[model samples]
Target: MEVKVASPSASRRSSQTKKLVGGKRGCHVVVKVFPCKICFRPFTNGTSAHLHARTHLNSAELEKTSLFHAKCPHCQKMFFVHHHLTDHLFVHLSREERAEVAQGWRHGCYFCTKRFRVSSHLNLHLLTHTKEKLGGICHVCRKTFTSKQNLTRHGFAHLSEDEKIALVKQGRSRKCLFCQKKFPDNRAYHVHLVSHTKEKPFRCDHCGALFGLKYNLNKHKLIHSEDPRPFKCDKCDQAFSQKHHMTSHKRTVHRKLKDFACPVCGKKFGRKSHMVGHLRSVHAKIRHPSPHCGKTFTQKGHLGIHLRKLHPSEPSAK
Candidate 1:
């Protein structure tokens, strides 16, 4: 946890030192004598040396260290902050080198290279990656936790009613028989149970839409605002409130980039969903077949869409 603080005299002392030839190959013949105290890597000035010291802040042996912050794929050097790593690539790496390895950079996000100053902010950002598909629910129990710590201690959720009540009296657990989901407090337990009942107390005032989560309701309310669409397409006049939607628009429309292509057919699609839909409709046989006819569809929703279009007289499919 203990860190060595850089003294004010570092910069002054660096200025007094004479330039010398570096030991590393391809290094400048006459480089600034100032070097990192720990690694002895040559730098132009002491300020850079001090900044470079942050790279050493992260280590498996250190108690105050963070997750692998910023790793250089080239020399295997690490930087403690993303901005510092960015500066390293721009200043130390050649233009062609940066372009060659730019895609290798890793971040907390699986889909994008977005970086955050705080680890907690990064943790929050990661939830977005799962929320769209899984609705923030844990794949293990098919339930979501308000806090990350709760998910770790989820085995307690399976306790019997008597044991759960006893734990609640001991100020430890909040569980019920219905969903078998545990909470840290009585308030959270009550909220979790309400979701099971499909109450959806949080209602949007603008469109009269109900939502189970208050945060979801708040997000829905933004659509009715004067300037709800904050994220705008740089190339086009179209805009969207969410950053992901805007990014999808750019990829599908402006960029016309396709990451996935069908092996059976040479057809391509920008979005993974589109590619999947194409595969299920064109190539793969359907699992859901109509009882009335031999017609088949990849999804129940797709079948329902067909029914509405072809058989307008027929009632809506449940």
Candidate 2:
């Protein structure tokens, strides 16, 4: 259950370096990191490496004390660490619901009667009732959003009345004649065109949402759904159902500053995914599914089951 952090050069280290540093440590493996002295292949992070190195300086008394800790709710067995408790809980969940509940304990948490689309939703929702509190606000509208992302979306409404009218008149949707592909935005359509021309011009500022066209970047903007979207608060940790609602709440109540920008067109994007999608459609030549797959995905939920039955491991229709 102990998750290890992988080092940047773990694969390239040599055994000779391990022997030089580890010496007579009881651990069977002798591993070393190329550049980082505190990191090695055998241990995931600097903390583990330092802890292991401690064994060389002392014996049993100096070693981290092995002790009994948390108890399992069902089996009544004691675990040595919190992770072991977590692993045992997973096993319990996988089997307990099948036996304990007479009918079925719906997908919602036992404590809250609220239903969720997925267990992940329930888990995140549980955080609200728990001790976790992360929130945000919008500066222009003086509104409060549950998360930072909602505030960003609210800023979109602050765009000039002229710009909103212009975008609406332009028709946000379009199609690529070359690929015969349809997209929700014109920028996406153009990005698809660049793929045939082989261009990879723009790079994502945060990570790798790179693209060859500005519009493609715009289309990518709709992809990321923040935790506190419509009513939530955190920028990265909260979840939400709608972007506009979140933004409105932030600006009207909390006074959050807007800082989103488009990487391809140099225009500002209200949200990050909007920009990424624009870049992807215009410049990135993504291979669409075969016509057969497209035909099977006429409905949203049906597409999930179709892809699951056909390509169980690939992206599902959902």
Candidate 3:
């Protein structure tokens, strides 16, 4: 028989058929074969060829072309990854120019100097900073919130004006005996009482840790499990399991913005919760009245101390 060699396409098809029969399946099986420009290695898939071509590039060329072959939308600069392209886009502007642009375009949190992609997200994040009880009170349930936005959200659970009138006519009121607070329903009343009783109904399976809220229990379970931390900081070596932690780190450590200020003492805090805690401890004057004697203090802990020292005969609440 005369010696013969098959055409490139025919040889590729033959190889593909052999691979299919051997139970080897991939993108290279269907696509037109191409050789890498740098190494001249045969690759049926373009993406594989592109990736293989990168191995031949030096460090400088790799850095220059690295962004997964993505082109920047703003300056048309090429980068290896999407984030690299985004970072490079900022390099086109000066510090003053960037600051001026940020004034108009950036949606940033006042407490930690964290910037958000959207205004709604920024508004939602701002709620985390207001640790003090909000003045907005729900007329239907007498429930207070830290913000009018939260009050509006709580109002959705209550009956409408017509429904309220009908309930009044029926002489039905859902009220708690312990706190004398009204609720939308009996279920809401019972749920409210759980807070005062400090009930931990939700129990974790992996760890016997109990949480009052089901969501808090779920969040706690993440600590016990081996979860992947996909969100990584591009500016530093640090990586966080949660996006909020990453955002917080960027704000407090990188931006160094202390937006939360105590209303009574005028002390600045990086977080709203810290400011609220300081106010409660130093200024709130929340005194637990002694059942035996009329004694008051700033903190519940102090009341406990007084009870232990002066009124040792009386039993403590906890």
Candidate 4:
């Protein structure tokens, strides 16, 4: 009876040992083994578990990045690291965007009817048309991102004026050295870089609008609005809402017909746009917005603001 009991006990002990060894068939020998809660995959140790969590984190990050980022202002892709975004914005700040603004027609999506300085800007414009929700809902505005990095950056936009002031006072000027541009946070800057490259990985099969930038493209869809321009001009028989519309009208219609000759030189132009081009070429000293003004603006909006504040009496129409 004693021999029989010992034999059964030894067999049971061997069975328990086999079970433990079988569980570790594919596991590394040096590290502790455990099951990952998120992925359900067996991990070598705690470090591996932590690293594995990043896979789960990616979904959140992608949403945040997509929502906050505009587009690759350069290549116009949705993917980028922190430093790459900086390198891209340098292109926009270059002469290209400025020249397009001068030409009156900016780069915009024909499908969405949205315009931007760069193709990347149009990429972000496309994200708004997405229907899917990403990441978690932002506490401040209920907005979402593909990731937390995007969400956190967006949160700063909701900061109060005093909070922003405090942040600036702390000597925390979050600027990217590559582009010499500044942002409230790294995430916002990272998100902004998405506007530089043209890589829309996510595409919609329905509308056929290819977007690399965002998980959500619902904002790109158009909706009818009550905001309509009713103002029309009698001199050239044109319509406008803002005063600039009238100026664009005059430039396109009446001014284009006028053969004005410069008194300083023998140059004739039908319109001011053509004359501005002529002046820029021959009399480089006589710049369009004034070379001696000690300031150069990227867009007409900035010049309009300057005129409104500095020279209130001057007409600042288009």
| Candidates arranged by lDDT, highest first | 3, 1, 4, 2
How does model 3 score by TM-score?
0.29
Worst 10 residues of 2 by lDDT: 32-41
Can you write out model 4's per-residue Cα lDDT over 5-37, one digit (the tens) per residue? 121121232111111222434432232354333
TM-score of each: 0.35, 0.23, 0.29, 0.23
Task: In model 1, state the lDDT of residue 152.
Answer: 44
User: Relative to the unseen true structure, what is the C-alpha lDDT of residue 11 in candidate 1, on a scale of 0 to 100?
Assistant: 27
Residue 30 lDDT (model 4): 37
The residue pairs that clash in candidate 1, if any, are none
Model 4: what TM-score?
0.23
What are the Cα lDDT values of the candidates? 0.58, 0.46, 0.58, 0.48
lDDT (Cα, 0-100) at 14 in candidate 1: 33
Query: What would the C-alpha RMSD of candidate 2 be, to one decimal place?
Result: 20.6
Taking the tens digit of each residue's C-alpha lDDT, what string does model 1 give over 8-95?
Answer: 1322433334433345453433434555543345567778886775443323224554444554443233455576566545434443
Off by over 4 Å in 2: 1-40, 43-88, 98-134, 138-259, 263-266, 274-318
Model 2 lDDT at residue 35 = 25
lDDT of 2 by residue, 88-136 (tens): 4644342235345423435666676566545756766775666343446
Pairwise TM-score winner, candidates 1 and 4: 1
Residue clash pairs of candidate 3: 66-80, 67-79, 67-80, 67-81, 68-80, 134-146
